[model samples]
Target: MTHPIPIFIGVDPRERAATNVLIDSLTQNSSVPLAITPMVTPQLEKQGLYWRDRDPKQATAFSFSRFLVPKLMGYQGWAIFMDCDMLARGDIAELWALRDDQHAVMCVQHMHEPNDTVKFLGEPQTPYPKKNWSSLMLLNCSRCRALTPEYINRATGLELHRFHWLAGDHEIGEIPGGWNHLVAVQDPAKAEESPLLHWTLGGPWFREQRTMGEGLAAEWFAARDDAFRLWD
Candidate 1:
């Protein structure tokens, strides 16, 4: 029998609702088998890996937890790491099928600044180079020895995200933009075609964000309701 694909998601402990709904969306659309692991803060803490969210601009439970994905996989086979605020409209198998072994990591190279002044929970929208590239990654773990616990524990956000750990930019590969389409940033027409909808700033689940036009909020709500039923 074929083994299921391993997917590690970075879920902020505070955003359980969004995380669960993201899981539901993946399950609803994925054609391939998956071993979904939500890398919660408490669980990582229990394992002696603290959530070192030292940056004032970042506070998501998995803001830094995503770096642990490769280490957790024992630097073995390929694994996918995604932010919890994403909703999948296309089959995950399609994304998985795009994997190439030549590169250490693969993600959409989003190339624009965020329009908003603040992000979810009013965090300052600090725009840096290669923003959101780390939000969704297809890791070739065997070649990703640099993401070790010790390195990730002390590295600054820039060092971790700016391809400092890798040999050079060529080691990083690119994926299609539709796979990590950012909400509120992409052209409305293009956003509609994206297979993955990422609420990089925030989503409709928040009471204060209900009026925000996600264009795909309905799908998130429907998925959230489905996830709620499973837990009930």
Candidate 2:
């Protein structure tokens, strides 16, 4: 039997436009059947309950806790979690193939040097070798559901006092780093060959065009109109 391979994307009501652009791009390039799941955080409903209220570094933690973990637990088979800012350039069959492995959680390494300027406003430089981008992740849902809760609990329980310790654990196991490309801070030379471009900082809508070297964005945008109509 062929297992289901679903593609998930998260979006808040505030980011509807970017979300639409992302979905349009994915539909255009995707050859396999895909599912888009929006990421919503409970903090958005409660005033003054923002990530900054707890740990500024944990800005994205609640979204993962409230939405991603639960969704993965319920989803059977393989799922690809693509950030709302990513544009797919080619067939994602390789990503689906990776999910067949029992011990792997597909992901990409962060291209920015450890001390690159994008670090949080008041956060200290990371002592670790470097960080990985969380923008695109492919997982065997069965394996992820087993560990998602534990990871979420650990991330949520970190003391607000230890601000620098708030980074999410991206090192699950032997997943490739090419799946998630960090466009802005990525090395231009390296990005030239990446399959997926993640508009981590600002996407095409805000910038009016692709800027982080030539990438799949143009093709993705070209196909958007038809793809969006079909997906809708």
Candidate 3:
């Protein structure tokens, strides 16, 4: 018998509602076999490796490094590490099939275009032109376990507030841009064709006044309702 392909989603428990919505969306829409893993940061006093204070951002990367990636290493299948805010536009199986190549990971390009600018550490900044996608990443489990610890250590050492610049060289160890499409900043015409839509500015919940541009906000609400059912 052929072993089932395994797809994994990671969530930090602190963002419970968002994470639940993400998992619900995948289960209800995805045709492939998948697993939702909540990546929790153990309290400093409780046990295991602690990455200094629980700075939410650092804690997130560290959880992937110290826990999630290693746990999946035992398996010989493909894995996708999705952020809680990523909502799938269609079947993600297209991405899974790309694993046939020996690439360690596949990601989208950073989407901020030439004219778009962001402020970083009080200075005007443009997106790092080189970093492959960071929002959604697909990794070979075996390869990830080998590099996760070092990635985590290096990521944690950087000042959390300055993440945009300190995010570091993606070419040193990340896949090409096509796999994880950073859709939010793409031109409106191009955005419509992307498979995954990442909420770059902030998550769905963060926009208290405006809804997510199109029908997506409604879709997110429906997914969130389904997620609540999982707990019940």
Candidate 4:
């Protein structure tokens, strides 16, 4: 039997419910075992990772947490990191099956621009090179020594998100776009084919956005319903 994959998810306390839904989607679809960990601020604090010292502004709650994934795995073997606001539409085991020892990290490369000026909590929607690339990553932990707690505690968000940790762009392996379909940014038909759906702006938890009733949201809603079927 294959060993369970270690998957760390960036979770903000404000979006705990959404994070839970994301977890449900991952667990429900994957046949392979998974060791899932949610990186929340309080938990990080207990682990001696004071994230706020790095981003005093707290612009994005989980902005720096993604960097901690490699370190959390003890800089050994391979692991995966994903944002909490994502839903899996396909087998996560398939994504786990992909492991290229050649690269330090594997991610869906996205050339994206923001349609809005602000994010879910009215924070500025900052765009930079290789946007959304870090949202979902297949990390080769041994090669990701640069993501140490000391380094992450001092590095700026821009430095982390802009692929500065690696020696160059070539170090990053590309994954299929279907692994990270950005809602609203992608074409509806094409998005349907994606195994992973990222609600970058705000998911169903956002009252106003939920009421707006975007067509792409139906999948998330369905996943949410299935996730909570026992409770309902």
Candidate 5:
């Protein structure tokens, strides 16, 4: 029997609705079965799985808790992690197929630098190298032994997000940029046609960001409406 593709998504109370919409979009577009879990920090903390203080630079609740995926998976198989504030416009199976076991982790590498000083919910935006690389990743869990709970709890933000625990740069792999096309930070041409679209600046979910990604937000709203229809 084929195992369902495993996926972990960041979930902040502030964006819980956004997370649901993302899950719906993924399930709607995927050709394969998926096991999607939300990385709700409070739940992880209550279980003693995550205990790190939120970094001042962290724009969202899952900024650091995301590093726990390997341990959460028992370091047994591959899994994908994605930020909640995104919409999958194509088959997630395609992204799953890009997983390369040769490397410990695979993600769409981006040189994104957002011009906005603040994002949705008035969160401060901090620029650093490889800022959004960890937002979406395919992990070879067995190869990511360095992501232990202890290390993740004490490690600096850059250490975890930039693949610092890996043996070297050679252990990191790259997926196609189209899979994580940042909404306003990347080329509009690509973000407009890309299979995956990320609202790195802010998504239309927040009242303040309702008009942030205007041209690129139709799919997000469509997915949002579809997801809420079940509840209403």
Candidate 6:
């Protein structure tokens, strides 16, 4: 309780609204104080922490920047990383309590098979083992020393997302699947079972994909509206 729990979120200009709502949801549903830091690409570039060229297949600005959390934390204590397109329906303190120091990083090992060839903004969907696993992580920074600024800037997508930095898959711990429930790729009914909702395909913020997850879309819309109402 001495310090607020550090939470690093991936942020993109296009998903600013999503990010804002996510922050609102996190604080609203958390018992503990949070130190939420958005890994904004522009700021990272300005600070000389990130300088990777935009990949055509990259859907968001923070796709690669998420790997730099350990370095950002001075490779010290534990910290969390989550995507902007998420809504926290349960207390974030629960998730924070699951952080285990035995592993380098922990995340939900999702069996994400793309339901579509493209996602929001016509971004190509590249399917691979353990896709959204990196989307949410409990980073034990000292153990993740392999995630240097130089390594992050140039590592391939497979290497970064699949956790090639760690010694083996065993080093990568697993969190409950509900913490990172993928909206469209996973079952719509299961959406209600999850504490967090992830609009990996796209969220209600995007016009065309607004209804991407049917029943689950309402959750994000409600969160967004509530966030807006609070702001007003």
* Highest lDDT model number: 6
Q: What lDDT, from 0 to 1, does candidate 3 have?
A: 0.50
lDDT tens digits by residue: candidate 5, 1-232: 7689999999989888789899999999999899999999989999998898888888898998898999999998999999999898899999888888799999888887778787777798877788899999999999988899899999998888888899988887999888998886766787756888889888888877776667877668878887778652
Q: Candidate 4, which segments miss by more than 4 Å at Cα? A: 54-59, 211-213
TM-score of 3: 0.67
Candidate 1's displacement at residue 154, Å, is 0.6
Taking the tens digit of each residue's C-alpha lDDT, what string does model 2 give over 1-232? 4444566676645446667767766665666666666655553334222332344444343334332433354745666776666666656766677654534354555545555434322333332333433456665565544344444444543321122232334424445555676665566566566667676555555444443334545544554555556542
Q: Candidate 3 clash total? A: 2
TM-score, per-candidate, Cα-based: 0.93, 0.65, 0.67, 0.93, 0.95, 0.96
Candidate 5 residue runs with Cα over 4 Å from true position: 230-232
Q: What is the lDDT ranking, best to worst?
A: 6, 5, 1, 4, 2, 3
Tens digits of per-residue lDDT for model 4 on 1-232? Answer: 8989899999887788789998988888899989999888778878886555645434457888788887788889899899988888789989988879999999999888877778777767877788889999999999999888888878888888887999998899999899998887777687757898888877777776783227767767777787788752
Each model's C-alpha lDDT?
0.83, 0.51, 0.50, 0.83, 0.87, 0.90
In model 6, pairs of residues that clash are: none
Question: What ranking of all candidate models by TM-score puts the best one first?
Answer: 6, 5, 4, 1, 3, 2
Poorest lDDT segment (10 consecutive residues) of candidate 2: 157-166
Tens digit of per-residue lDDT, candidate 3, span 96-164: 666633555556545454453532122233344443254566655554443433344445333212223
lDDT of 1 by residue, 1-232 (tens): 6578899989876677888888878888888788999898788878976646557766576777688888899999999999988888889989998899999999999886776678878877867788889999999999999888888878887788776899898988999999998887777688777899888878887887764545477767877777677552
Model 4 pairs whose backbones collide: none
Candidate 2 regions exceeding 4 Å error are: 1-4, 42-54, 59-63, 114-130, 145-154, 157-177, 207-232
Candidates in order: C-alpha RMSD to true structure: 2.0, 6.0, 5.8, 1.9, 1.6, 1.4
Per-residue lDDT, model 6, residue 99, is 87
Better of 2 and 6 by lDDT: 6
